[model samples]
Target: MIRFEDVSVTYDAAPGPTVQRVDLIVPEGELVLLVGPSGVGKSTLLGTVSGLVPHFTGGTLRGRVTVAGRDTRTHKPRELADVVGTVGQDPLSHFVTDTVEDELAYGMESLGLAPDVMRRRVEETLDLLGLADLRDRPIATLSGGQQQRVAIGSVLTPHPQVLVLDEPTSALDPAAAEEVLAVLQRLVHDLGTTVLMAEHRLERVVQYADQVLLLAAPGEAPVLGDPAALMARSPVFPPVVALGRIAGWSPLPLTVRDARRRAGALRERLAGAEPRRATPTEPTPAPGTGRRWAGLRRERTAEALPGVVAASVARLAVRRGRVEALRRVDLTVTPGETVALMGRNGAGKSTLLSTLVGLLEPASGTVRVGGAVPHRTSPRELIRHVGLVPQEPRDLLYADTVAAECAAADHDADAPPGTCRALVDELLPGIADDTHPRDLSEGQRLTLALAIVLTTRPPLLLLDEPTRGLDYAAKTRLVTILRGLAADGHAILLATHDVELAAEIAHRVVILADGEVVADGPTEQIVVSSPSFAPQVTKILAPQEWLTVSEVRRALDAGGGEPW
Candidate 1:
């Protein structure tokens, strides 16, 4: 059990308390979900439970927090390791060993557990998280999602009474996320474990939570209540809940099953109605030509953009060490298209992105971006054709402050000064220029990295897991920005596990599996057919093929009521 008594946290030279007067109790054997917009102190509040807030983060705590009869104020994180296990947003930062098996056993070793006991827990965790196959793989060689599982298993192996997780499933694919969440449920129900998790992807975890905690805004008093009651008024929510609100369903649904149960009449209402035609922004005109480019049109598609291949891959094969990461994959992107690359963990999605970005040389076949082979193109020349924002945003940022990073981006892209800074401000408002990049929240850092990549305005842009840390509002801003870029004749290829994002933004979806293309087609066609990949809206209104809340709202609005 965890208890927060009059808790308030403030840092040096801060505007105000990050979390103010938060008084609550988390009963044992229950799962509590902390929900809020980014930077509302969700991470800060979680840190208080593990004593990472005022102890290691150099913040001032005004009240007390106790976990399992042990006062966090008196016990440091190491001292509470026996009862508490914490996993932050960045799994790479949580590793202390080289291989998956070693990392899983490291915590128990630190706890001085018997070797036999440690081995048993390690094996159980590996199986529980679906990490058995990856147990022997080095952490550095694993995919982002794989690393995430290893990080989680490391904490779970210690068999702590309390688990505090931050965005636990952000990097996982749909099935993997389900497995991890199910394991957490088992812990809560069968083993009497307490889980306090903070996540931005409410769609994946809201249905699993026993209770909901809402931190509406900075310094605002927190609200604890039933999940349905909280979701009805919560500013940030999953697409299923949003759809429920639109249908005027009593007791807003938290899961796809709940939404589908009440969707029979709504399905009939939309039986004959088709999703609204998307109207992407018109392409900007050429320098001397008043008309739009011949390669693009108002309805952006690859067919319209003839002879305007932004990126082309033909029978591409890439090998990492001895592993065949990608195998004979053929794909094409045109000037005005947004393609989402989707798959499970180790499905070669990231491998293909890396090949396009020229970070990993293809073992065979060809990879061309803007008519030049990406592997052979010089960095300076490549900047004119393509740009990449990787999964780990920190890899693209090395500046001491946000200002310096933006200035460097402008210089590297040969753009006017302050161009990159303006993009950052647009994507995420109110980020101070003087702030260090390392001090930023995960979502903030990813936004800054995206702004840096966007500075070039390259013809082909590739993003890996772009929505990892972004909240719904920030993700909306991002969707608008990306859509505008596509309208401007920029081709975007993003490898992601965020199905909702693909539903909202992608014109097409391509799924890869075990280094092969498994499915590729229009977003509606591909996502609606696959139960694992479908978004909440599509699942709720099955047999209708609707993919997003926006689509349904548009259909209803355009029809002016029931006849839609």
Candidate 2:
């Protein structure tokens, strides 16, 4: 139902075309997944379906693009509203209304659907996405996952023939992501809808795609083929596929189950072998620095409490209107600790992060960061103790150019002039210094926000969904920076749904459920034990101790030959 005939697009800002000579067809009623590294034109490709490519985005399209027998060249986004629904990476930017229910209905209203039909679809979408409880909540007040659901629901309510999503599940927790994908499956199988989705979280959606559309690189022709076939050679693939390649499995497994069945011998070989753990950079001696030999030794359980509490939340009761976002939530992070906060969507993970940053006041109980109450501290004084990179990175950025933002960060924190700029280089290499912050890709924006927050070098750092739009390379850079900070006596609490990331860098894991703390312990203890939270390697080598592809490679390098 979607066809791209020699399509090429070039934006006004950048050199050359981001997408070029992309000729492909997506059959009706099938789900096509767009896979590629960040800034490789995944979003730019999706924009062509609804005519957002050369229309709203102000780009030049060199070839024809059609959807449902309608040429997008002739149909603007407003004219094609009934045929295609598009959700970009940033959900907040897509929202035109304030409340959840209103936002869901707004699209239909714009399409001029009858009130009765719109209401019915609105209710159906609310139930389908578990947004019934949040129907009336203001969009701005909802958590990132909740906002993601609302953005999706708003589009789904239109009942379009084609649905385009960019990183649809990046903000969602495991179960909620499953729900969204399940709904898409139903749409494709039962309703004969065509869904074209672009996502960085391949493990969550690869198993469900009817076909894979691989964008090799800028100015390179795109490849369309079977999911497993494309994944074997693709740089951007799920961890399960990587594990399959490592073990020499035929027809590389797209899902964990397929890999697990072929993992018996590999599991046995790895049972006694230890994977290489993440190592922190060399210590930079500073007062209260505890990471002299970080990552070399596992955190000791002998001490009930670690030294120098960076932040603590005790009996925290937080409410957002009628919703009890957090109930009696008690958590703590010590200096040099890197904790991963995890849970299903609407499970109070974001709420907990907000509480840490003093954005939300607990209804009851006490909270402290660096021995000072967050909400009670002044803005000028707060930066020294805590810094937060919010789930929506755009919220933290306001300046026009990347240079201006970094310079502002340096000035704001009283740091050296080039401190933030240097951090930006370390995190997002090759990005132009003078580019507008608004023009950068989602991953680049997140990196800039992280740099800004790190400029202050607070003892405690809180990041919500730090890897949302980051490619593996960018994500690797972020992991290295975070590890170094933790080694330099910094405490980090990151809220994320990326299991692989959590497994890679997190020293400990804390799981929240229904507004309460459900599980908290060492990273290996929490993630490797839970099926839903387990990383790809953990799934394949279940009953063993492996947690990442790097770990498997490490075990193999330590003299364990191929099990097969």
Candidate 3:
């Protein structure tokens, strides 16, 4: 259905082609997964399918690109609307109507379909996407996951044969992402619709893909082949694939179930080969002091307060008119602790975070930050106690320079005038000091935002999906910064679907289902023990008593060569 013959796309302002010499063919009725690191032209490749590349983005294109036999250069997005359905990473940006039903019907109406046809298509899409109950709900009130589903439904209502989505589940939680992927799988299996999707979270979606298109970095050619083999050799792969590569498995496992089976065989083989001695346990630190020592010991210890509460939500209930976003939710956080807020899309994770930060007033119940009501506190006063880094980093940046952006958030009036400059310089290096905040790369912008928020040195820091759009290096940088802050008495609450990040950094894990806390406890207990919420690596390895790579490495080192 889609073909790219030596296709190259160059943006007006960029130095070179975003996608260079790409030759790909997506066979009809095939579900192809496009995987790569961020900014490798995955979105650009998808745009060519629906004529959004040279048409909407104002770019120069060379070579031939065709969708369903029609040349892309000749067909505009509106002209190809009948043959292809395209969904972007940001659902809100693509929305044409305010309500779910209207959005679903808008595309068909634009095509001048009959009223009966539009109504039928709308009803079918609502049912297929499980949005029947939320037909009349405002699109703005929907959760990230729900909005993404609505975006898909709005495109699919026209019954296009091919569907192209760019990081459709990037904004969604695991459960909600699963819901959207399930729908996509059904559309391919039952409805015979072709799917071409680009996603970074490969562990969740790789098992269902029929083909894999692996794009290398800029100036490199794309790799295309079987999903399993590509994952094993690819530089960017999930933990399971990494394990499979290390284990020397043939026809490597792509899913947890496959990994589990292979792991069982490997364990049996090793057990039969030799008898192993019992491993010695390491000495535990004193009750409250974790593993920190020396210069950082005092800061780590100060993070643990005996009786001080950082944030509290009591019987909180939020409603958008008649629809309840959150219902009677209660939670609490303490200083120096890292709490992970997890839930499927529409399970009220964002709503709960907004209410806790006083951005959204709860219809019922109370929210307290450091024993003071968040809603009652002034915005300036709240800045000293709590700083919220929203999902979209673009929303927080307004200064001309990265240095100026950080300075605007500095709350210390008595401090030196160059304090913000020093802080930003310390946190973010290599980024030009005078570069426009909006012109920097997404990862750089994210770092700049974190630096800006940290300038205030807020006691309670709330980050909503900080890992989105970040590469491996950027993610590592973020983890290092967050760890330092958590060790220094800051109460960090991260709302994210990146389970690996939670396993690595979070001290506590809280799972929200239907707007209520279904599970809450230590990260090890919640992530390792729970079946539904286990991290991908944990599911594959099932180590005796470790949740992170560092923990596993420590255990292995102490075991004297025993496998963890």
Backbone Cα, N, C clashes tallied per candidate? 0, 0, 0
lDDT for each residue of candidate 1 in 1-564, tens digit (9 for 90 to 100): 899999999988778898989999999999999999988999999999999988999879988999999998889999999999999999999999999999999999998999999989988998899888888888998999999989889999998999999999999999999999999999999999999999999999999999999998887899988999999999899999999888898899999998899899889888878986343234322132323222222232333234578899999999998789999899988887889999999999989988888889998999988887888988888777788999899999999999999999988877778888878877889889888998889999999999999887777889999999999999987887787777767889999999999988888899999999988888878898998999999989988889999889888887786532
lDDT of every model, 2 decimals: 0.88, 0.85, 0.75
Candidate 2's C-alpha runs over 4 A off are 275-307
Which runs in model 1 stand beyond 4 Å of their true positions? Answer: 279-307, 562-564
As for TM-score, the candidate ahead, 1 or 2, is 1
Top model number, TM-score = 1
Q: For residues 26-58, what per-residue lDDT tens digits would candidate 2 score against the true structure?
A: 999999999888778998899999888888888
Q: In model 1, how many backbone clashes occur?
A: 0
Model 1, residue pairs in steric clash: none
TM-score of each: 0.95, 0.92, 0.85
Q: How many backbone clashes does candidate 3 have?
A: 0
